[model samples]
Target: MKTTIAYLATATALVALATAAQAQDKKTLAIVVKGLDNPFFEQINLGCQKWMSENADSEYQCLYTGPASSADEAGEVQIVDDLLTSGVAAIAISPSNAPAMANRVREIAPDVPVMTIDADFLEADRDLRTTYLGTDNYLMGVKMAEEAAKLKPEGGTVCLQLGNVAADNINARAQGFRDTAGGAEGIERLAGEGGWTEIEGCPVFTNDQADLANQQMADTFIANPDLDAFILVGGWAQFAPQAYSQVTDQVMDKLNSKELIIIAGDTLPPQTQAFRDGRSHAQVGQRPFEMGYKAPDVMIQLIEGQTVEDPLYTGLDVCNQDDPGFCKDN
Candidate 1:
C-alpha cells in the first residue's frame, strides 16, 4: 500500500510539471485597433487587456496595436503582415479600408483566425476573414438620421462630415443616412422628409485628420452659416484640442443655443464627455469595448481548435443628457 501511494504522488508531480511547461509556451494573440488617438479604439484596448487579465490562467499572450493615422490602409496591411511573419496564434483587426485589406487577410486566414472588428472585408472577399464582430453601422446611421429629424422638426439643411472615405463603415453609414435623412430610399422613412436638403459640397471627406476635420467644418460653416445640422459619421476632430482652433468663436457658441445640431457616432470617454459638455445634441455609441474584449476570446478559441460564434456582433449604445446611463463613469 505504501509503494502504491508513492507511485500515485510521483505521477501527479509529472503531470504538474508538464502542465507548467505547456503554460510557459503560450501562443501570442495580436489585436490591431483603428488609431492611437481615437478613444473608441482605446476602449478596444481596454477590452483586450481586460480579457487577458480575467483569463490569467490561459496560455495566451495578448498584443494590442494601433496606428497613428486613421486613414492609413497600407499601415494596417503592414500590421497584419508583421503579425503573420512573427507567427501569431491568431489575429483580430479593425481595417481602415476593407477593399484594400481583403487580399492581405486572405494570405493569413487559412492558418489562423483573422477576425475583423469595426469594419469588414469587401463583399467579394468577405470569406477571407474568419469572422466579423462589429456594430450594424447602417442601423446606426438610421438612428442618427432619426435623431436629426426629431431636432429639426421644421426640416432644415444638413451636411454630413465623413472620415476615411474608403472605410466600409463610413460608406454604409452614408447610405443609411441618405436612406432616412437626405434622400428617399422608399423605406418606412423614420427621419427627415423632403424638408431636409443636402448641401452640394456635402459629405466632405475629412480623411480622419483632427485639424483637417476642424478646418472642413469651420470652412463649411463659414460658407453655409445656415447649416442647421451635421451628422458626424465619425468624431475625428473632436478627439483632440486642435479641433477647436479652426472654428470661429461665434460658430462654436451655436451649440449651446441649439441652433446647430451635431450628432456623432462611436462614443468614447472623450466624445461622451464632449456630449455631456454640450458639444452635440446626442451621441450614438458603438461598443468598441466589447469588440476589443471579445476579439481575444474569439481568437483564442480559434487557436484552441474550438468553435466560436461566426460573425459575432457588438451593438450600439445611444445616450443623451437625459438618460441615466449618460456617460456614467466614463
Candidate 2:
C-alpha cells in the first residue's frame, strides 16, 4: 500500500511540472486598445485573433484587452501597468490620453518591447514606445479637407469635430484639416483663411462619447444654421448608427443640396451606410485591421532584436457618394 501511494504522488508531481513547463513555454503578445466597447477596436481584436489562429503552432499567443469604456483614460493606463507585470512578452497600446499614457510609460519603463497601435504618444514623448503602427493621421485629415475643398471650392463656414482633447492622433488630424482647409499652416481657427471661417464655439471635443458627439452635432447645426461644412476627425458620432442617422436626418436637406458638406474620418459600416443613404458627403478611413494584423509581426521582430520601421503606416481608404467603390464592409 505504501509503495502504491508513493508511485501515485510521484506521478502527480511530474504532471504538475510538465504543465508548468508548457505554460512557461507560451509567451503572451498583448494588444491593449482604448476601449473594448468600440467596434473599430473590435476589428483590430479580430485581426489579432486571426494572427493567433494562423500561428497556432507558435509559442507566442496574442491577448487583446482594454478598458470597458473609451472615456476611461485612467483605466487604460492602469491596464497597461498591470500587463507590464503580468509576464507579457510584448505590448501594443492605442493610447486614449497621449500625455498621460506617455507619463505612465515613462514611469514604468517596462523591460518588454512596447509599441503604439492606432494612436501614439505625443511627438515630445514618442520615445516611450518602440514604434507606431497605424494611419498617417495628418494625411487622413488632409484628404478629408481636400474632398471638402473639391465639393465646395470657395470654402465656407466649417466646424471640426474631434475625439479626446489630448489624443495625439486626433490632434494631428485636426491640425491637418485646419491647415488644408484654411490654407494656412498652424492656424488655430479658420478666420477667413482660404475663404473658410470656423464659426464661434466650433471644433467641439467629444471625448469619444457617441451619444454626446451626436448631440454636439445637432446643437452645432441649431446654433449655426449657415454652417457650410462639418468635419469629423474621428468616428465618434457615426459609431452610434441610430443616433447619427437621426441627427443627420435633420440636416438631410442641406446634405442633398450640397450646402452642408459632411466629411468624416473612418469608413466603418455604419458611416458607409450613412454615405449611401445620402446623409454624409465623404469618408476618409484608416486600416484598423491592417494595424492589428501587422502589430504582432512587428512585436515579434522587436522581441528578436530586429530593427523595424518607426511610425509604420498602414494606409488609408477614401470613399464618397460619387466614388462608392472605395468603401467596402470592413
Candidate 3:
C-alpha cells in the first residue's frame, strides 16, 4: 500500500510537469477589446477563433478577452497589464480609454510586440504601439456626414451621439463629422457654419451603454422636437434592436418623410435591419471581423521581425436605404 501511494504521487508530479512544459511551448497571441458583451467585439472574437483553428499546428495560440462591461475602462487596462506579464507573446488592444491605455502601455514598455486594434491611442502617443489595424475612423465620420448632407441639403439642427468620451476613435469620427458638415477643417462645433448648428444639450456621450444611448436619443427628440438630424458615431442604441425599434418607431413618419435624418456607425445585422425598417437612414461600418482575422498574422510578422504597415487599415462599408447593394444581408 505504501509503495502504491508513492508511485501514484510520482505519476501525478510527472503529469503536472508535462502540462507546464506544454503550456510554455505554446505562445499566446491575445486580442483584447473593450468588452466581450458587445456583439461588435464578439464578431472580432469569432474571427480570432477562426484564425486559431486554421493555424492549429502553429506554436502561437490566439486569445480573445476583455472586460465584462464596455464602460469598465480600468478593467481593460488591468487586463492588459496582467497579459503583459502572463506569458503572452503578443497583444493587440482596442482601447476603451485612449489616454489611460496609452499611459499603461508606456509604463509597461512591454518587450513583446504590441498593437492597437479598433480604437487607437491619441496622435501624440501613437509611437507606443507598433501598428494600428482598424477603420479610418475620420473617413467613416466624413462619410456619415456626407450621407446626412445628402438627405438634408441645407444643414439644420443636429445631435451627435458618441461612445466613451476619451476613446480616440470616437473623437476622430466626431472631428471628421464636424469638419465636413461645418465645411471647414478643425471646426469643433457647428454654430452657423455651412448652415449647420448643433442643438442645445447636443453631442451626447453614451459611455457605450445601449440602454442609456436609446434613452438619450428619446430625450433629445422630446426636448428638441424640431431637430433635423441625429448622427451616431457608434452603434450604441441600435445594438439593442428591440429598444431601438421602439424608440425609432415613434419618429417613423419623420424618418419616412426625410424630415429627421439618422445616420449611424457600424453596419451590424440589427443596424442593417434598422435601416430596412426605416429606423435609420444610413450606416457607415467598420470591418471588425477583418481586424480580428488579420491581427494574429500581423502579430506573428512583428514577432518574426518582418516589415508591416504602421497603420494597416481594414477599410469601411457604407450602407443606405437608397443603395441596396451596399447593405449586407440581415
Candidate 4:
C-alpha cells in the first residue's frame, strides 16, 4: 500500500508539471502602440514579434494593435480592452492619454502585467504598471538644448515645434527644452509669432496647413533672420527646413549652410535620412528595437520568479552623421 501511494504521488507531480508547461506554452503578450501608421512604432512591433517567435519555449504570443490615426485614443482604449478580453498574460503600450485611460486600463485587466514603451502613462496610479521602458523625456530635452547652444554659441531666437499636446511624454520633452533654453544665457525664446504650440504644429491632411505653418515660420524668420537654431520637441521641426525653404528665400539659402541648427528626438529611418540629407543636425536615438526586444525578455524573467523593476530605461543614444551607430548599420 505504501509503494502504491508513492507511485500515485509521483504521477500527480508529473501531471502538475505538464499542466504548468501547457499554461506557459499558451500564454500571449499584447503590444499596443499610439498608432500603427507610424513607421517608428512598426519597427518596435516587428522587434517584439521577432523575440516572441525566437523564444518559443516561453510559449508567448505577440499581438500588435493600434489606432487607425495618430489621434485615435478611443480606438487605442478599445484595442487595450480587446487584448485583455483575449486573455493576454502581459501587455506593453505607448499610452495615448494617461489621465483618461488609467482607470479603464486598471479595471479591465487588473492582474495582467502592463508596461509602457517609448511613452508612458504619467497620470496613472503608481502601481498601475509593471514597468516603463523608454528614454527619459526630460533628459532628451536637455540634450537637444545643449546641441542648440553649440550651434549658436552667442545664442539667438530658437523656434520650438512641440508635437502631440495630448501626450504627456512629448509635453515633458517640450517643457525640458523650455527650462534648459531659458537657463542658457543669451538664448531668447520668442513669443506670439515666435514659439509654436503642439496644437499649432499638429499635422492635418491639408497641405495648406503646412504652407500656413511655413509662412508663420517665414514670418518669424523675417523678424529675426538671425534665428540661427531650432529645437524640435520631436520630429516635427525636422520638416521645417523643407517647408521654410519653399516659403522664404532666406531659409532656402540657409538650408545647406551652417546658419540653421536643427536638433530633434527619436532617430527613425526617415529621420536618419533627413539628417544625412542635411535637414537635421542631430537626433536623440530612443533605440526602439532594443526596447522591443527587451520587453518580452523582462516579462519572461517575471514569469520565472525574477523580480522586474519599475521604469526600466533600456538604452538611449545621440546620433549625427559621423556616429558609426547613428542609424541602422545597414
Write down the TM-score of every candidate: 0.83, 0.92, 0.92, 0.75
* Cα lDDT tens digits for candidate 2, 1-330: 543444344335434533553576877788888877788898898899899889988888777777777887877887788778655789999999989988988998899999999998999998878899999999998998899999999999999999888888998898898899887799788889989898898789998889999999999999998989999888889999999998988989999999999998888788888878887888998888888888899999999999899989999989876677666453
Task: Give the runs in model 3 whose Cα sits over 4 Å from its true position.
Answer: 1-24
Candidate 3 C-alpha lDDT tens digits along 1-330: 543444344335434533553676877888989976789999898889899789988998777887777877877887788778655779999999999999988998999999999999999998988999999999999999999988988999999999998999999999999999999999988898888899989799999999999999999988988899999999999999999988998888999999998999998889888888888889998888898999999999999999989899999888886784456575
- By TM-score, the better pick of 2 and 4 is 2
Clashing pairs in 3: none
Q: Which candidate is the best by TM-score?
A: 3
Query: Over the stretch 1-330, how does candidate 4's per-residue lDDT look in tens digits?
Result: 543444344335434533554566667666677766566677788788788778776567665666654556666676677667746677888877666667678787557777787788875464687778877887788777666666656566566655454676776776666567666333333332223222222222211123444555556656656666656566543334466435444564575676866676777666666666666677876777877778777766655667777778766678764562565342
Task: Flag the better candidate by lDDT, 3 or 4.
Answer: 3
Candidate 1 residue-wise lDDT at 144: 84
Best of the two (2, 4) by lDDT: 2
- Considering every candidate listed, which one attains the maximal lDDT? 3
Candidate 2 deviant stretches above 4 angstroms: 1-24, 328-330
Cα shift from native, residue 179, model 3 (Å): 0.6
Model 4 poorest 10 in a row by lDDT: 199-208
Instruction: Note the residue pairs that clash in candidate 2.
Output: none
Q: How does candidate 4 fare on TM-score? A: 0.75
Cα lDDT of candidate 2 equals: 0.86
**Residue 249 displacement (Å), model 2:** 1.1
The residue ranges of model 1 lying beyond 4 angstroms of the native Cα positions read 1-24, 107-109, 182-193, 245-248, 321-324
